[model samples]
Target: MERKKNISMAVIRRLPKYNRYLKELLRTDVDRISSKELGERIGFTASQIRQDLNCFGDFGQQGYGYNVKELLNEINGILGLAKEYKMIIIGAGNIGQAIANYTNFERLAFNLAGIFDVNPKLIGLKIRDVEVKDIDELAGFLKATPIDIGVICVSENSAQTVCDMMVSNGVKGIWNFAPVDLEVPKEIIVENVHLSESLLTLSCLMNDRTYS
Candidate 1:
């Protein structure tokens, strides 16, 4: 299973769409589904799906297809969704509050522990049952609580500083929403979500076809 674990990241990324299609099939009582049929639902070719799944052990039979529930569990396990992950948001701004209140993460085994903000007036606020605390308490709170991941939504000016603080607090992974790129130690994993860049790309696509 060395090779399986090696390609696990790519496989995990595709699990959501695969699980979505599998859920639809399960609703129809589809006990077994062929790679071709699964491909049609997600726009992937049969060969591609087979190759990706091949990294893991064979799940499909020679004549029949894969069991719906079995495949769902396998994919979920590979994606680390089989276990819940505790996370905290490091900003109480519009984007941060929206993310904290988002229901999507709940389905994927992620629990929003709390939200932090520098503003005193917003510190005691609640978003989707998760209380907002002062940013000053981040280090202490993290030390006391069980938080594996942190979502950074501070301003661009303070992005690096906030990221540094999070790293110092022993956060393993960070989802950065600031416009500026952050510099972190090699051990920390940082995923930047540049909303403006995505919008600009879409605008360029619509306004000018040259880039496209």
Candidate 2:
């Protein structure tokens, strides 16, 4: 496996887009697809697709294009989708509950180990099939459970503290949905998903498209 540090974040980010289109192609029973055909469907140019994929490894033949299922599996492996990652969510709020209810995580090999919150009212509640646990139990829970990822959906004020706790307790990755930016050691892999920022960026692009 190639070291992730050698690849640009730009290439890494486009991986999910490729995976999504490949899955769609599978649903339509498309066995093979050329870069040109995939680009037409996904809005990326053929050259860009080829270049991005080449960074990881050569996946397609010059005349043969790519085997749809084979390419999907390769991309999935590159993205660590084949490994079952156990994750826990902190802050059983609206965003947290929504994440817990997401059915696609299992398909992607990310298992929800537990959900946590400080609220006494939510402690016994269940989101999807996972029971909500008290936030106070998080320290002990991490000791017992082999959690690969910690997801933060808490308010800005509490986000950092929760993240620090997760990291200190041996969590390898973090999927942070909190509004604030977290400061962590270089070793911790963190992906910050700022929903409001994405929506605002979309709104700006839409207005720009309309004006142009």
Candidate 3:
């Protein structure tokens, strides 16, 4: 896929949502859908959907809107879902274990290569058949395994160290579930998933609605 220049974060973020909705539509046996119809289902305007998709290239026909299978394939390629990515979790706590157990990752081509933790108790335990290796082995493991993504599920204190270790060992993408912002080179892409922050945001919105 050609690198898209100047794509907004908002648009980049929506691509996955689009892929998800399209997948659901496929399961329903919906072959093709117009922009107006898709917008109604996904909460975006027909014009907005077209504009968002056009950031990469024109995908829909002038009258036909979009072919669901073709559009899904195109979006998959755009999101790098077409390639199988090897990823590992830096911590094997509840969140890390849950993520390792998720079956969706395999469907999306994100192979859980391994899981790691500093706790000796967790080491050698299997979460969904992926053994929790000692965190001390992470460095050596990366040297031999060609992992593309590193998931940081450690505490805030250990997040930076784990992120740095992953980057230094040639991991290009970091999915940080740890609550701290990690400092990495600009070339290394980081997606921070602040679960508490999202929950708090929801709380704030509900509070505002109560006051309104």
Candidate 4:
């Protein structure tokens, strides 16, 4: 299927939620579902669901709705879950170790290639089968391995340096757990998981009393 360009980030963001919901439906042996049913589950209106889906190619039929498994497969392809990605973590700290320990990423085709750290205590630690190596080895490792994603679990001061090294070594994707926003080239895709910011968002919501 041909993908259209200029798709808004809002729509792109919603695709993951749809992907998750569809996976749940598939696991429960759901065959098909209309937009209204899906919207109700997702708290979106039926028309809103249709509009968001229409950003991609035609998915549901006029009356048949969507074929659950097929829709999921298509969404998976859209989210690049169909391909295998080699990932390396720079910083074997709490966030990095937690990411390494998450087994689901491997199932989603995100294979952890290596882990690096500046601290001597953490340098030799093994999260799973991947041993944490010295941060000094990062440059050579990146040159040797064509990593698809570089995870930045280092501090704000070191995050940009790590990102630069990864970008220079053919790593276009970055999953950053650092608090600071990283500066990268236009081609580089950085997805940040700022823990403090997320918590602050929750705090704001609670104070506002607007959570539904």
Predicted candidate 2: what Cα RMSD to the true structure?
Answer: 1.6
Any residue pairs clashing in model 4, and if so which?
none
Return the TM-score for each candidate structure: 0.88, 0.94, 0.96, 0.96
**Model number with the top lDDT:** 3
Better of 1 and 2 by TM-score: 2
The C-alpha stretches of model 3 lying farther than 4 A from their native spots are 1-4
Model 3 TM-score is 0.96
Model 1 root mean square deviation, Cα atoms: 2.4
- Model 1, 62-130: lDDT tens digits are 678788899888877766777888999988989998898789898887999889999888989989888
Query: How accurate locally, in lDDT, is each candidate?
Result: 0.85, 0.92, 0.93, 0.92
Pairwise lDDT winner, candidates 1 and 3: 3
Lowest summed lDDT window (length 10), candidate 4: 203-212
Per-residue lDDT of 72-119 in model 4, one digit per residue for the tens? 999999999988999999999888999999999999999999999999
lDDT per residue, candidate 3, 105-192, as tens digits? 9988899999999999899999888999999899999999989999999999989999999999999999999999889999999999
Backbone clashes for every candidate come to 0, 0, 0, 0
By the lDDT metric, which is better: model 3 or model 4? 3
Residue 52's lDDT in candidate 3: 92
Q: Judge candidate 1 at residue 175 and give its lDDT.
A: 95
